[model samples]
Target: MKKKKQEEKEGEEEGRKSMILLSERQMKEIYERAATIGAKEALKFFEAERKKEYKGRADKRLGNTKLLLRNYHMLKDHAEKSVFGRTQMEESALDILESMMSMYDNEVIIESIKRSATRTAVIVSHIETMLGLYEAYCDKSRSREIERRRYEALWDMYIAASTMSPKEIADKQHVSKDTVYADLRIAIEKITALIFGVDGLTVR
Candidate 1:
């Protein structure tokens, strides 16, 4: 057993010496090949992870935006009434409300609501601004005719304060229900980008 162990040790040392004797160019070639293969596999892994993460984020974003739009007037009203002395700038009102809340007891539920309301206020403001921008974008040319209709569809469906159903909006816009649904999707995507910036973009 001792002799076998000694032989194994000798073999390891010989293998190490042989490895050390490899020419620099040969080592470089081996390293390059390993790196190339490893990098490809690593890239594939990361890309898959990125795509999965993107899908999760996109779903959350779209769902939240749709919920907000469906309850736009309620959220706007809640922010206004909940925040005392509401200003023209709803976001500023929410900011003041948050500051005031921080002065009181550290109630977890109230603090959570304050934070949610603040975020909702900011998102509401972004939605309003996005609509204004879309209006201007539509005025640029007749080429934006479809975009104009899509914009109106979104407005009537959500921001008009008297929200309409998809079928109602389709009838009002003289389009198919499928077209109305498609428009709402595009509008929500635009709002997602407006609210979340580059991170809101879909992976595909």
Candidate 2:
């Protein structure tokens, strides 16, 4: 009886070992599948994030283009002015305390404004150059009539600083309001690419 009991105990030990080994094999297979799935999911997530970032950058570029065009005249005026001299800074800060006078002399603010003015001048010059090219192109070929209309629409709406409404622009262009709006949009898209580079062009 004691020998039989010992044999039964040995059989139970062997069974437990077999079950453990089977479980380990199954776990390894599950882990491999999970890793594969996780990698694919990670890649998809990364791609989606990249697209969002790209779209965000494109939108920002478009917004900047619109802003620069709208403020074209004002920026040009600012660009023509020389940087503030020491006397000018002192005069501007005359009311402030002596201790706070250093704020007026802050090179950082002055440099930042100077840089902004320079960039504005550069962008405005690009707009003018592009418009000049467009004018020449429009005149060179009657087939580009629609393109010419779009260019005129953009100029009247922004570059000319005219107070003309969209309806007025449409009447002047001899097109529907919707056409004028579309032209303006297309013009802005083209200029956005010019100002911000090719990547500024949105997919849509």
Cα RMSD for candidates in order? 7.3, 10.4
Cα TM-score per model: 0.64, 0.66
Superposed Cα deviation of residue 155, candidate 2 (Å): 0.8
Which portions of model 1 show Cα errors greater than 4 Å?
A: 1-35, 82-120
What is candidate 2's lDDT per residue for 1-204, written digit by digit as tens?
999999999999999998777577789999999999999999999999999988877776676567666666766677666453344342221122122223333443234333554443444456677667656766676768887888788889887855567899988878899999999898888777765557768765
Once superposed on the true structure, which residue ranges of model 2 sit more than 4 Å away at CA?
A: 1-25, 82-119, 133-143, 161-163
Clashes of each: 0, 0
Task: Assess each prediction's global lDDT (C-alpha) against the native.
Answer: 0.69, 0.67
TM match of model 1 to true structure = 0.64
Candidate 1 per-residue lDDT, tens place, 103-165, comes to 433344233333656554654565677678767876685868788888888899888867789
- Write down the worst ten-residue block by lDDT for model 1: 97-106
